[model samples]
Target: MDWIVPLILTVITASTPLLLSATGELITEKSGVLNLGVEGMMLIGAITGFAVTVSTGSAIIGIIAAAIAGMAIALIFAFLTLTLMANQVATGLALTIFGVGFSALVGSGFVGFAIEPLPSLHIPFISDIPVIGPILFGQDFLVYLSIFMVIASGWFLTKTRAGLILKAVGDSHESAHAIGYNVIGIRYMATLFGGAMSGLAGAYLSLVYTPMWAENMTAGRGWIALALVVFATWRPGRLLAGAYMFGCISVLQLHAQSAGINVPSQFMSMLPYLATVIVLVIISSDQTKIRLNAPACIGKAFRPAQ
Candidate 1:
C-alpha cells in the first residue's frame, strides 16, 4: 500500500516525455505533415540540453537549449519535405540517423559529466496532503506543463480559428490554398513546434529523469511517441490517456525485473515495447476510426500554385 504512491509517481515521470513529444507530434500531424525524425530530434535535444546544463549549472538554460536544438533539426526536416518536396518518410529516417550520429559526436565529451536534477515544485500546503497532495502537487514543472499542454492542445484544435485553418490545410491543401491560407507556412510552424516539444522531451530525459548525459539516451522513446499519436486517433485527450498507459507499463516492467521475477532480463526489458506493438495493432484494427480521424493530406507533399 505504501508503495502505491511512489509507483504512481514513477509512472508520471516515465509518461512526461512521451506525453510531451506525442502532443507536439499530434499538432504537427493535424497540420497534414508527418515528420518521423522525432527520435533523432529528441537525441539532439538530449545532448544539447545536457551540455548546456553542464556548462551553466542551470537546468532551465539546459531545457531552453534542448528546445532550440530540437527546433533547429525540425527546420531541416521542414525545408526538405515542405520546400524541396522530399519524401517525408525518408527524410525523417535520415534525420533520425543524423541525430543518432550527431548526438554521439556532440555528447562524447559530456559522457561522464553529471548535473543536479530538476527540482520538484511542491506547493506548501497542498503538497502536504496525505495521499492526494504529493501525487498532484509534488511533481516537477514539466509534469504540470505536460498536462497543461494536453488541455491547451485540445482547446487550440477545437476552439481556435488558427487551429481550424491548420486543420483546413491538413484536410485539403488545395482547398486551404484556394481559401488563401498559406499551407507551407502553417506546416513550417507546426513542424517547428513538434521539434521543440521533442527537444523538451529529450531535455526532460537528461536533466530531470536521469540528470546525466549518455550517447543515444533517447533510445526508442521517440518512436513510441509517434505510435502514441496514431494510437490516440489524432485526438489530444486520447493521447494523454495513451501516454500515461504506456508510462505505467514501462514502470511496471522495471519493477518486475527489480522484484527478481523469474523471467529473463532481456524478456523483461521487452515488455514496454511489446505492449506498444499490441496497442498499435489493436488501434489499427479499426480502420474506420483511423480513416475518419486521420488527416486527409497526411504525408502528402504540398506544392503551391505558381
Candidate 2:
C-alpha cells in the first residue's frame, strides 16, 4: 500500500512529457499535416529550456523560451513543406537529424550542469491527505497543465466550430478551401501549436523529470509520443490513456531492475520501446479503425488553388 502512491507518482511524472508532446501532435495531425519532426522539436526545446533556465534562473522563463525555440524550428519545417512544396517525409526526417546535431552542439557547454527542480503544488490540507490527496493535488504545475490540456483539447475538438473547421480541412482540404477556409493558414497554426506543446514537454523533461542538461536527454521519448498519437487513433481521451499506460511500462522497467528480477539490464531498459512496437503492431492491424479516425489528408501537401 505504501509503495502504491510513490509508484503512481512516478508514472505520472513519466507520462507528463509524452502526454504533452502527443497531444500537440494529435492537433497537428488533425489539421492534416504530418510533421514527423516532433523528436527534433523536443530536443531543441529541451536544450533551449535548460540553457534559458541556467542563465535566467527561472523555470517559467526557461519554459517560455523553449516554446519559442520549438516554434522557430517548426516554422522552418512549415515553410519548406507548405511554401516550397518540399516532400513532407524527407523534410521531417531531415528536421530530426538537424535537431539532434544542433541540440548537441548548443548543449555542449551546458553538460553536467544541474538546476533546481520545478516546485510542486501544495494545497494545504488537501495535498496532505493520504493516497487520494497527494495523487490528485501534489503534482507540479506542468502535470496539472498536461491533464487540463488534454481535457480542453478534447472539448475543443468535439464541441467547437473551430474544431469542426479544422476537421473539415483535414478531411478534405480542397473542399475546405472551396468553403472559403484558409487551409494552409489553419495548418500553419496547428503546426505551431504542436511545436509549442513539444517545447513545453521538453522543458518538463529538463526542469522537472531530470532537472539537468545532457546531450540527447529526451531518450527517444519523442518517438514514443509520436507512436502514442497513432496508438490513440488521434483521439485525445485515448491519447491520455495511452500515455499513462506507456508511462507505467517505463516505470516498471526501473522497478524490475531494482528488484533484481534476473533479466538483463539492457532488456529491462528496452521494455518501453518494445511495448511501443507491439502496440503499434496491434493498432495497425485494425485498418478500419485507423482509416475512420485518422485525418484523410494527413501527410499530403495542400496547395491552395491559385
Candidate 3:
C-alpha cells in the first residue's frame, strides 16, 4: 500500500515524454506530413539539452536548446521531403541514422556526467495532502505540461478553425490547395512543431528523468511514441490513455525485478517493448478502422500546382 503512490508517480514521469512526443507528432500527421525521424530528433535533443545544461548550468536553457536542435534536424527533413520532393521514408530513415551518430559523437565528452534533477513543484497547501497531494501536485513542470498539451491538442483539433484546415490538408491536399490553404507551409509548421516537442521529450529524459547524459539515451522511445499515435487513432484523448498504459507496464516491470519477483532480468527488461509489439498487432488487425481514421494523404509527397 505504501508503495502504490510512488509507483503511480513513476508511471506519470515515464509517460510524460511519450505524451509530449506523440501529441506533437499527432499534429504533424493531421497536417498530412509523415516524418519518421522522431528517434533522431529526440536523440539530438537529448545530447543538445545535456550539453547546454552542462555548459550553462541552466535547465531552462537546456530545454530551449533541445527544442532548437530538434527543429534544426526537422528543418532538414522538411527541406528534403517538402522542397525537393524526396521520399519521406528514406529521408526520415537517414535522419535517424544521422541523429544516432551525431548524438553519440556530441555526447562522448559528457558521458557519466550528472546534473541536478529538476525540482518538483509543491503547491503551498495542496501538495501536503497525503497521498493524493504528492501524486497530483508534487510533480515537476513537464508532467503537468504533458497533460495540458493533450487537452490543448484535443481542443485545437476539434474546436479550432485552424485545426480543421490542417485536417483538410491531410484528408486531401489537392482539395485543400484548391480551397486556398498553403499545404506546404502548414506542413512545415507542423513538422517543426513535432520536432520541437520530440526534442523537449529528450530534454525531459536527460535533464529530469535520468538527470544525466549518455549515448543513445532516447533508446527507442521515439518509435514507441509513433506507435502510440497509431494506437490512439490520431485522437489526443486516446493517446493519453495509451501512453499512461504503456508507462504503467514499464514501471511495473522495473519494480517487479527490483522487488525480487524472480523473473529473469532480460525478460523483465523486454516487457515494455514486448507490450508495444502486442498492442500494435492488435490495433493493426483492424484494417477497416485504420483506413477510416488514418490521414488520407499520410506519407504522400506533395507538390504545388504549376
Candidate 4:
C-alpha cells in the first residue's frame, strides 16, 4: 500500500508533460494544421526555462519565458506554413532538427547544473489523509493544471461556438471560409496555443520532472505526445486516459529495472516506445474511428481566397 501511492505519484509526474503537449497538439490538428515541431519546441522551452530560472531564481518567470520562447518558435512555423504556404511536414521536421542543435548550443553552459524542484501542494488536512489525499491533492500546480486543461478543452470542443468554428475549419476550410470564418487566422491561433502548451510542458520537465538542464532532455516524449493525439482519436477525455496509460508503462519500466527483473536494461528502456507502436498499430486497424474523429484537413496548407 505504501509503495502504491508513490508509484501513482510517479506516474502522475511522468504523465503531466505528455498531457500538456498532446492537448495542445490536439487543438492544433483540430484547426487543420499539423506542426510536427513539438519536440523542437519542447527542447527550446526546456532550455529557456532552465536558463531563466537559473538567472533570476524564479521558477514562475522561467515558465513564462519558456512559453514565450515556444510561441516564438511556433510563430516561425506559422509564418512559413500559414502565410507563405510552405510544407507543414517538411517545416516541422526542420524545426525539430533546428531545436536539437539550438538547444544543445544554448544549453551548453547550463549542463550538469541543478535547481530546486517545484514544490508540491500541502493542503492543511486533506493532503495528510492517506492514499486518496496525496493522489488527489498533493501534486504540483502543473499536474492540476494539466487535468483542468483537459477537462476544459473537452468542454470547449463540444460546447462552445468557437470550438465549433475551429472544427469547421478543420473539417472543410473552404466551407468554413464560405461561412465567413477566417481559416488561416483560426489556424494561426491554434498553432500558437499548441506552442504555448508545448513550452509549458518543457518547463515542467526542467522545473519539476528533473529540475536540471540537459541536452535533449525531452527524450522523445514529444513524439509520444504526437502519437497520443492520434491514439486518443483527438478527444480530450481520451487523451487524458492515454497519457496516464503511457506514464504507467514508462514508470513500470523503471520499476522493472529496479526490481532486478531478468530483462536487459535496454529492453526495459524500450517498453514505453514499444507500447506506443503497438497501440498505434491496434488503433490503425480501426480506420473508421480515426476517420470519424481526425480533422479532415489536417496537414493541408490553407490558402485563403485572394
**Poorest 10 consecutive residues by lDDT, candidate 1:** 257-266
lDDT of each: 0.93, 0.92, 0.91, 0.93
Can you give the lDDT of residue 218 in candidate 2? 90
For model 1, the superposed segments whose C-alpha errors exceed 4 Å read 258-260
- In the range 85-124, model 3's lDDT, one tens digit per residue, is 9999999899999999999999999999888888899899
**Per-residue accuracy of model 2 over 1-306 as CA lDDT, tens digit each:** 788999999999999999999999999999998988989999999999999999999989999999999899889998998888788889988888999999999999999998988889999999999998999989999999999999999999999999999999999999999999999899999989999999999888988888887888899999999999999999999999999999999999878966779998799899999999999999999999999999999999888868
lDDT tens per residue, model 1, 181-286: 9999999999999999999999999888887888878779999999999999999999999999999888877788667778877887787789889999999999
TM-score of model 2 vs. true structure: 0.98
User: What TM-scores do the predictions have?
Assistant: 0.98, 0.98, 0.98, 0.98
Candidate 4 is scored at a TM of: 0.98
The runs of at least 3 residues in candidate 3 whose Cα sits more than 4 Å from the true structure, single-residue gaps closed, are none
Residue pairs whose backbone atoms clash in candidate 1: none
Pairs with steric clashes in candidate 3: none
| Candidate 4: stretches off by over 4 Å | none
lDDT of candidate 4 over 82-188, digit per residue (tens) = 99999999999988999899989999999988888877899999998999899998998889999999998999899999999999999999999998999999999
What is the model-wide C-alpha lDDT for candidate 3?
Answer: 0.91
Model 1, total clashes:
0
